[model samples]
Target chain A: MAAAALREQLNALLSSMFASGLVDDQFQQLQMLQDDGGTPGFVAEVVTLFCDDADRIISELAALLEQPVVDFDKVDAYVHQLKGSSASVGAQKVKFTCMQFRQLCQDKNRDGCIMALAVVRNEFYDLRNKFQNMLQLEQQIQAQQ
Target chain B: MAGAASAAAERKVTIRVLLVEDEEIHRVLARALMKAVGGVELDEAGNGAEAVRRVREGGAYDLILADRQMPVMDGHEATRQIRALGVTTPIVGLSSDSLAADVDAFIKAGADDFTPKPLSKEKLNHILAKFNLA
Candidate 1:
């Protein structure tokens, strides 16, 4: 039997994820994958990939912004890709931030891009921590079982 | 540990959970919660259509926890479809925005209960108990 304490922890994590709007329906898709014999590791894998992609995109975006004559089109492309991936994974906050970032890019506001980058980075770090904590909890549960 | 195990064994009853969701994160969290709750075997589908398919193919489920909105088919359509198929699995609509109107709509579409997002232990337990599953 699974321990109630562990269940409580998982529930708390989920509640926070929802309340914070860090996750959405896409998280549910990850859970379904687990029920289908996709281990928690599968979720970690997908999320790690997302994190990697986000990091790369953010770097590229920063580089674009550093240019003497910022290429709004290139920056917009990166934002678009980030938004799509964030949306796919149900990272509601990140996706929303990316949307704002895209708008700022269209407006050619270097200052806006810089501010949005901070928001995006903060959100990314927060989500990463949350996901990592959840994964740790899952590992703990598995260990207890 | 021994006492807890004995107590659990005495009250052990498998919970057949029908998970209706379109996202991966919520699905993972829900599964973890279900497992932690003990006595749960979860069945899942990405959207309403797949959920209905699983129900039709897998037979009756003890409970259904479905998301409000999804692609290909929404929760309401899935619930309606399941009811149309004559499957009486108790469905609880899960949504971040569980407005009264939304709850009413889900109920009208054939949901037996409603649990809003972030999914608190109290809320989930309450819904499960309503269906005599907890």
Candidate 2:
């Protein structure tokens, strides 16, 4: 496909992401920072890092909750880490889910935490899929150049 | 946009910054953000303890940006430790927790100010201006 058309499609996808609250201005701020030079693909790099971080933290949370005696403090800490990473990359939905998950952890509600973890994992996967699409478009744009 | 970038360019002072963040991705983002601002020399410390050690060994940083929550030692304790060492460079606390108590705790621990996490260009510049680094 032509670079301009690919660019427009990418823009439209990004716009829809914002409209759907899948991402926020922090993501745009990251893109702007990338445009200012130094790191050519800063946003994509951060997003990839975020995905890895999220995967580890989510798995940790799941395992912790699976133990006979769940450690609420440990659960809360992992959720906090996930929330921070999500906010850094402007993954709005995942960050929000992490917030709720943290509250459940704080309350020491084992059942609530399990439910929240499932929800947050789903949110993370959804955002990750969108990010993969965005990254693919970015690569195509670069190839055309 | 263009105006902000130009203004940052006009500052022309290479402010040396020690950024204390546990997460590598955040450190990477900070590096890019500072580069956008155009004249910043950034150093990294994984946690508060490392930050304190760096300052004690005479890092000569113009500013310190400490993330409030870290594994080894949090920003609050690090700020207190750095202050105990008599290093009086500006310490700005960063956190995703915007709670008033958190901000107050950081200031009480000797941080000069507090800013919410995921630092944007404007916030970075604001910190510089507030500390006279700009």
Q: Which model scores highest in TM-score?
A: 2
Which DockQ value does candidate 2 get?
A: 0.58
lDDT of 1 by residue, A1-145 (tens): 3667877988899889988899987676656545554354767766776788888988998888888999998888678667756764678899889878988988999999989988998998899898888878878888888
The positional error of residue B19 in candidate 2, measured at the CA in angstroms, is: 0.6
Reference-based lDDT, each prediction: 0.77, 0.90
Please give, as one word, the docking class of candidate 1: incorrect
Query: What value does the interface RMSD of model 2 take?
Result: 2.3
lDDT by residue (B2-49, candidate 2, tens digit) is 654676678766779999999987888898887777678899999999
- Candidate 1 has an lDDT of 0.77
Interface RMSD of each: 8.4, 2.3
Model 2 alpha-carbon miss at residue A25, Å: 0.5
Model 1 C-alpha lDDT per residue in residues B23-131, reported as the tens digit of each score: 6656756665565455677888899999888888865788888887677999999999999988887888876555699789999999888876656445666777788
Q: Could you give candidate 2's per-residue lDDT for residues A1-145 as a string of tens digits?
A: 9999999999999999999999999998888777757468888899999999999999999999999999999999889889889999999999999888888888999999999999999988988888999999999999999
Candidate 2: deviation at residue A46, Å? 0.9
